[model samples]
Target: MAQLDISSSAISIPTLLIVNRYFDEVTSNIRERPMPWEGYQRASLITEQELLLLRNYSSRTGLKDQPTAEKYIDLFLILINKLSRMDALQYILVAFDDTIQKFPDTLVYLCQLEVKSEGSPFNTLKRCLGKDDDYLNLKAAKIITDLLNHASPKFVQTFDFTDLLLWLNRQLQSENPNVVDVSVQILQGLLKLRSFRPVFYGKAHLMNIFMGLIQASREGNPQMLYQLLFCLWLLSFEPIISDSLDKQYGVISQLVAIAKGASKEKLTRIVMATLKNLLVTAPGDNLAAMVAVKLLNFCDNLATRKWTDEDILDDIEFIRQELTERFQKLSTWDEYVSEVESGHLSWTPSHQSDAFWKMHASQLAADRGRLLNCLAHALNVPNQDPTVLAVAAHDIGQFVKYYPLGKKMVQDSGAKQKIMELLTHPNADVKYRALVALQVLMSHAWDQ
Candidate 1:
């Protein structure tokens, strides 16, 4: 610990005047040098002892009012740049804590200078971040983040870093679009640096904070949302960090919902790409089924348009092909039952599982009367598709086959009349389902 030597009253008055005159000469000489960036490379060649002297002088009582503060700050930044260039960052690391504490405002201004540098600030930061000292790097990261949070739009816009994730987080909370945009850009840059990966992962709540940004995009900030989603997508490519199921499911669910409702074709395509990325990375039976169900709903909506029958049929064929492929991947009913019985089914389909389609199939086969009531409600909606109606009817017929009680419920509830009317539907699938349901009812009556 170097002590301040301000109490040396025994020193001659002439010596003090000479020191003051030297200070004036030094300040005057500093004016001859070019701007900070121009002189940074050369001035940073100064020796450690000289650098310490400058540091000490910059901290003297009258130094703040003297022109020396700005010059010293500039010279220190040159040293930073040199450290970055010569890879002598450990030396800077030893002094960074005290340097920042004594001149917090200087660190902020140096960050601005780095941002304005012509060469890559990202690469420079990367060199500094690669030092073996974690505490120093973390301190530097904190300072950079603080500076970026309060930096003007111009400074923030040109900023880049490989260890500024903390600052990126602060920028994420900014209300300014330009700041947010630049911050995201900076994050993207940092993410590309392999050295920063551990730092990024160590920052807890990072994934959740990003997801919150994704959710915010739904209300009209798709640009920021898209940037965040893309970053998450890129991150998911890394096996070690991307293995968390909660992070995967949360991001995917939001993306899938957005894809389903997005009117813009490009955004829809991007969302679809994100979904595909997720599936490729962490495919599960339930997730596959949920995707299939969403695709089916999309197809059903598309079918209602008054297009040529041939075009509609072609679209339906494509959708059916996709659904069939996905459905084949779903666990069979017997498999599900076995899993449930064996306690292997940790997730319930009704709540977290996307097996609602299969559940619908099962309920219809075991309880026609309940199926009929559900159909009644579905049919009441205007512009309801006949295919959905037919599927419901087929499910009901299956229920009647497995459960005699379903027929009793239908007959007792007068749902049989509705089933008979559906038999006259123009769509063959609906008529077939309706006829099959009615025949099952008649058979039950005859058996009795």
Candidate 2:
């Protein structure tokens, strides 16, 4: 007879309460603390009948009765009592591997079982990262990532993200780019953990996680770059993170390089989205200004992006609008170098809008940068769009003629060369507009 650890009172067979009573009796004296590897040992902990049941279940190529298997939940309870460190880890790892293979149809159900436990397969996998089976470690890491991506937060949070990040960070130093890439991907999964936060993953002794992420963006791996950019997009939501990226590493510049160099549509789109997230957080920020300038690199070929993916096009448009709005609000009077160069109008308004105290002269004259940027954009891409060039040149003419210290500062912007380039333009109206704008800006020289 299989003896209970404690005595059980007999009750009717088919009821759940009676079953619990019997289970309580069986396990009451069972050891609460298990040795790790005890569960993995060939010497099974459950009754002979239970062992025979599992043996019968294992013999079949398929699961005939999954619910009946569930009824044998005491397998875990018994192991939790008897398993030691090594065997417990080995048990879960084998179970994870077998569950994936044996129950392809029950994957979600089976993975959920491991995911919600602190001692689950991935926790064991994390420990194995420094072990000799790196290939298996990566394979297991990938499986864990896929599981965590789909797992519920309640289950995902059960894993310790800090430890996972530290392990993955160490793996980033692998000689194989594929290894580094997989490690980066696993770190991406760590970001999705419910309790995950953006604490710096440590550079005091080793390469910090964010540094690795930034470096990956600049390196040649598109897959790694995509995952890194995705994390940055999420991290950018936090002020501490966004500010650290800007103030400490100037990561925004690296992101621009990545976006500019990326040939893949998906890679470019994520890089673009990541930049947008960073810029949107503090539009008036210094890095925002640099990023705004960096973003202009695309202006010369904006049409190529117009036919790109709809999602990327939307991101481009968002960046465009935000930059335009932010720059408009940024005072440009301070940037005007005319009077300082010409030694006239010794003092200018502190505000660009105040430059138009002579209201109705032209809004363009009030902000010199806006007019210069407008003309530059037109002259670059609107080479054939004459009306764009015309309006832009007309704005420059007004800015040069009416704004304080206009001619000197406008000339200092290299406006003369742009105007000369347009003078021979094929479109008569565009040529005329450039000619007029230049005449106004250079009128002082003619007068002198």
Candidate 3:
């Protein structure tokens, strides 16, 4: 929409032009050719002169005629509701897409019309989403996206987009790359609307789709990957979504992997921005999770590279500094918990700190010895890192020496037998740690 003084809105005109042209380019090919007037007349829809006027409206701009716009909208609704023929419907949709984009008055006018029943133009387009033809579905989605972009707050609040949002969710998993791309781009736009966030987020399968796309995009689809990450970047603005993304969906590891290998500058920029948002939104265990995934190391490496985008560098610097500061602030127990939960343990300070074990051993024994059981599982897993086995064995011994029921807990967790078997391990570090832990388990007077 433009202001009464066109000069005031001149700066935004170019951006508007780009958006309109892009929609025109990606919409159905039916817009290029003339409609089958003979077939439409055979179906008794409209006269030849009326079709010509509609065609003119499609190409015309700056249309300020209210009556003409309403007439065209009614025609589109009639064609959409009455016409079962796919091509005819597509022709009408192509016209609708053009008219609404070029003529602001028509878009505003259409949005103002209240929907009284299912056969409304908006609802009709929604129904087209279920059509078997991908082109029709795409056109329908584009129109819906366009409407929502300009629709009044009242209309958006009352409208039920659950079906449409679910369809978009399913379409993200589509094998067809174009469908997935368009769907993500639509979602990216929709998420910009604050009211739409909870609606889309409420869908149970949204995160699952994101997880799959994050994994799939790693196989070399930069456009799809960027678009998918863009949606995540938008969603990360919400504190609740950001929290769930890391805690429940485990997206930090996947996103970190993408950021680590992003070839395109834009891809790296978005991934960095998203990681930054997720980090800043909630930074307790989330920070630990990022650190455990070696994101800080990645940020360190990223910081050394020459980045053109200032935002990218800023995000990298911020994340690196935040991870570093918070990591230092993390308690010995928090560090130990992060390492064990990451499933990639190493010889960190916690494993050897006598005071750490003495202080947190009972805390580890608090959750029914959950952290202890995790260590026992890591110890028994075949082909685990010898350092990890060694660390696990040492922690078990420390737990036994500190906690009253640590020995029985180790036996219950099956780590006692695993530790005994590890005494014959090929790695000397693992064998020695196993022997010490076994002695502690047997209540022997072993030296610290």
Ranking by TM-score: 3, 2, 1
Tell me how far the alpha carbon of residue 320 in candidate 1 is from the true structure, in angstroms, after superposition: 8.2
TM-scores, each model vs. reference? 0.39, 0.51, 0.78
User: Residue 92 error for model 1, in Å?
Assistant: 19
| Model 1 Cα lDDT, one tens digit per residue, 344-431 | 1223343223344435444443444344465455444455567556654554555556565666665555557766888777888778
lDDT of 3: 0.73
Model 2 per-residue lDDT tens digits across residues 1-70? 1111111111111111111232233233222323323233346545566455445444543344555434
Candidate models: Cα lDDT each: 0.49, 0.52, 0.73
Rate residue 33 of model 3 by lDDT: 62
RMSD vs true structure, all candidates: 19.5, 16.7, 6.2
lDDT of 3 by residue, 1-448 (tens): 0112211211111102212333456454576766666666766777676667665666664245667666777778767876777877788787776666656666556666644443455777888898877667877787776666667666676678776876786687778766776677777666666567766777768767776887888897887788778777777767777777676666787787787688789888888888887887766547656756788888888899897788888888988888888878877677778887755677777778888877888877778878888888888676787987888898889989988777777888998888999988999998999998888877633332
- Using TM-score as the measure, the top candidate is 3
Alpha-carbon error at 362 in model 1, in Å? Answer: 16
* Leading candidate by lDDT: 3
True lDDT of residue 42, candidate 2: 48
In candidate 3, the residue pairs with backbone N, CA or C atoms under 3 Å apart (3 or more residues apart, or in different chains) clash, namely none
